[model samples]
Target: MSSYKSIPVTMIETDVSYHKPSQTFRESVTLEDSALEVMTDFTRVTAISINPCASLEQARERMVSSGVQMLFVTNQYHEVMGLITVNDLNGPKPMQAVSENGGKMEDLMVRDIMTPRLKLEALDYEDISHARVGDLLETFKRMGRQHALVVEKDTSTDKQIIRGVLSTTQLSKQLGYQVQSSHMAGNIAEMAQGG
Candidate 1:
């Protein structure tokens, strides 16, 4: 979508392969050229984040302010924890309903009902480059999973740290199609070109 010259993926291996729902493929994929110098580098990151200590209302506010569907949860030390999505705030707790006949910001706390243990449940792309497009598409099949906290180990501290957040909405927008449709397209993109 730009008029400038593009980055070429002419330097990588030609045996790039991926599997899809209907079939599998092996192809050579070229990427637009950029300062990063590689397609893999282009996927570094670009997501908004929040702290787990904040109130649920505060987290929701941050997401709304940032205009991001997902909010990466972090701790006081700035280590990544888990995540919360817009969908997580939509429903009411039965206890809240019984107590006040409705839920209010005051009725909720970040830890009271948030999908707990997200700090330990985060997943990471240890081999991010190997995660094919088909795998990405399969992730979209899950419900209410727009934001995912990617975990990585901090060797220095021997602690698990949050490295990144993956928003399905952002993925869909970037690819210009439903996340579910990306499997085949991604698999195709991963294949080796005949030329």
Candidate 2:
């Protein structure tokens, strides 16, 4: 080995606030931006994903810990198999699973309650780019979905890719007001009356 001087390492101390993680974004509650501009880009924000085989309890815990309302269920190849949201967890699916499984939460998995890709509806990037915030709100209301996926084809792979996600909560925060769907409200009223 040649006798060369090694650089000495210097450690600088920083404030704890500098290393702390940031809270959920509080977007300006205004509809000045388009849906594409308001949508959460996976490229910019890391999407939380969980395995399909993970227990429902585990998935819920992960979502709570990450402060996210939804988690993507992925396969061994890391491809999105489905998606589970807080709504799914609180809905009747897990109860049905538990009742059928001798009342055990562990018996339920993300795959059991997740909305499969086949049932998931997505908007094209081109369409969304030309859409306004009001258009997205109307779509979400009509579909009664908390989140909507935006998909696009990869030029090289020719496969669909999840480009972005529009979340109602995120949109409301950005729009500075709550946007409710008449259809959803009617459905809720009907359910309440039936019950």
Candidate 3:
């Protein structure tokens, strides 16, 4: 082994351009900033989920306990298969299932009443850059959705990932106002009448 000499280390400065300015941090943000700012990013909140085979009553209980209007129905591998919402429970799906099967609410499965994943629509996270809260509110109203999923292309994995969610209820609470959905009536006759 050879004897080694120790040298004093000098502090290395990072490139100033790489750092964000303090003013940028101090700037007051508004709902108009970007949809991303208003969105509940996955990094901050975990998606609430339920098993697809669970009973409608169980699903309702889970939703009540989770304090979410909807729950992602997952399979054995924990992959999203569909989604169940308070609307589905309070609507005709469960009743139709009960009528068809001649069984009680407990006999109705979440999968039977869930809105399949294929029917779900998502917005690109990049699109949020130019999107405003008002725009999102309008979209929710037009689409008759309480929540909207935001998908982002992960650079590292080179895959599209569900990155965030925007909720009308949450946004309304934050804004201190109610954002009503245009599809609230949700009657088939009204729907067929071009509502």
Candidate 4:
């Protein structure tokens, strides 16, 4: 039998501060930079999410509090059912939903205006892994989307798992310029065409 000795303990310091997590993004990045530099990797940071049945107000509150423009609408099992963005909350979708469903604004749920999983699309992580920021930007412009999901196949389950997200707002922050939305581009094109 082996005997274990107790180690001596020291008193805790009152003025000591706890360590906080710090994630640093490059102050500036060119389009030639790696796409991974702009992606919000789920492996490093937890994704913000909300219940599908939650009120639209609740969804908005969560996004505001989290400093995110989008939130995944998850089921009880934590499976993503859809996603909601700030545009869906503040745009005409809410009013349209109310008018179509004959419900008051307060009665609207997150699912009422969220983009369903069926309509959503993702970029394979394998492709993103080798892509440049410019390639990602071109993809976003071609798709006419402000945000895109990145997925990787789970080897054991053979299921697609959302691994990260690419957001134009985040890209803009990293690039030191605003990435125009599709709507903005459309308006610019309209003016150019003298319509």
Candidate 5:
């Protein structure tokens, strides 16, 4: 029979030279000044947005070619109005072809299925990957969002505001500073055996 071992969760705490008062709760790490900082600047957001009135078919084609999952739906005023996802295009009631329904492309537009512009801003991070993760966690807490439109400006009429798109999966992989559970516990077990 093999001997068994128990492992405890590892939490990191460091003292800063110029310390702000610490948080007073278990979730203090996230609630306190975040250990993870997310960012959205001009550099990261450099693409042009899609027109909200465009045909859903054209929109789907663009996402497929660009290899991105989300698009920024802009209005005549160039304000961010809504978001559309690849999955939305492929959903059961996805944008139906006008020909299939005896309609035309002009009759079918993106605004129909788009998640309305509730929170159209990007979640920022210091680390791109981690920031992305942080953005996603925040997005989910708010609910009804699958993508974040990364932007550089917030003004309603800023025509220069074409930012990158953020997917939840990409952020999680690169967003944390904590050691992986398996790595830490495995190393500890090895050390215990050696002693």
Candidate 6:
């Protein structure tokens, strides 16, 4: 039999707040910084996700509550089926979908507007590891996307896994300059000015 002693404990104090999960980045970064410095590594942070059958409103609510602009659409098995972004919820896509599919806006599902996995593109984790923030920004500009995914090969399974995510919004906050989505700007300077 093992004997144990109780340690002294203190009573909970009022007005004491709990710590929230937070990711730390450099206070500021230049475009020449490593791309990894700007990426949200899924290994460190849980990726926010929504079910494919979830309503658009539900997806929006989840994004707002989670403090993220994007959510991965997962199936019951938790496989990535697609992804939905704030733009997809607020842009003309919803209306267009309703118009084309003969459904009410309220009837729309996340999958109705999400970018399917087959249509998505990702950066190789190895390439990103060797790339600079500037290179990533240029890639975003060239691809006309606001967000980019990084995928790494799982050696054991030999399958690609979503390793991290990079967003222009996060880049803008780090750089202390607005970085407009590629669809919204012709160049970095234009992006800053546009914002």
Q: What TM-score does each of the candidates earn?
A: 0.54, 0.78, 0.72, 0.83, 0.47, 0.86
- lDDT digits (tens) for residues 1-195 of candidate 4: 769888999988999876634456777777778999999888878889999999999998999988889999999899999999998998999999989999699999998999999999999999999998877767877788899999999899999999999988988888776775574343323422432
lDDT (tens digit, per residue) of candidate 1 on 31-140: 22111111221125445667666777787788787676666566776544555667666655424533664466565655554564534344455744456543544444
Reference-based lDDT, residue 158, model 6: 98
Ranking the candidates on TM-score from highest down gives 6, 4, 2, 3, 1, 5
Measured by C-alpha RMSD in angstroms, how accurate is candidate 4?
A: 5.2
Cα lDDT of model 3 by residue, 1-195, tens digit: 879988999876886344422211212234455666567677666788899888888988998976789888888787778788899999999889878878787778898899998998999888876887656766786787888888888889998778877777776665555556764334323422442
lDDT by residue (tens digit), candidate 2, 36-100: 76787776677889999898889989999888898989998889989999989998989887777
- Candidate with more favorable, higher TM-score: 1 or 5: 1
Q: How many pairs of residues in model 6 come into backbone collision? A: 0
- Looking at model 2, residue 58 earns an lDDT score of 93
CA lDDT of every candidate: 0.50, 0.78, 0.74, 0.86, 0.52, 0.88
Count backbone overlaps in model 3. 0
User: Which candidate's TM-score is highest?
Assistant: 6
Local accuracy of candidate 6 as per-residue lDDT tens digits, 13-125? 99998765667888778778898999999988889999988999999999999899999999988889989999999999999999999969999999899999999999999
Candidate 1 colliding pairs: 6-33, 7-32, 7-33, 26-191, 26-192, 27-191, 27-192, 28-191, 28-192, 28-193
Q: Where does candidate 5 have its weakest 10-residue lDDT segment?
A: 23-32
Please identify model 1 stretches exceeding 4 Å from their true place. 1-53, 79-82, 92-105, 118-120, 142-144, 180-195
Candidate 1 has a TM-score of: 0.54
Which lDDT value does model 3 have at 101?
77
The candidate, 4 or 6, that scores higher on lDDT is 6
For model 3, the run of ten residues with the poorest summed lDDT = 20-29
Candidate number with greatest lDDT: 6
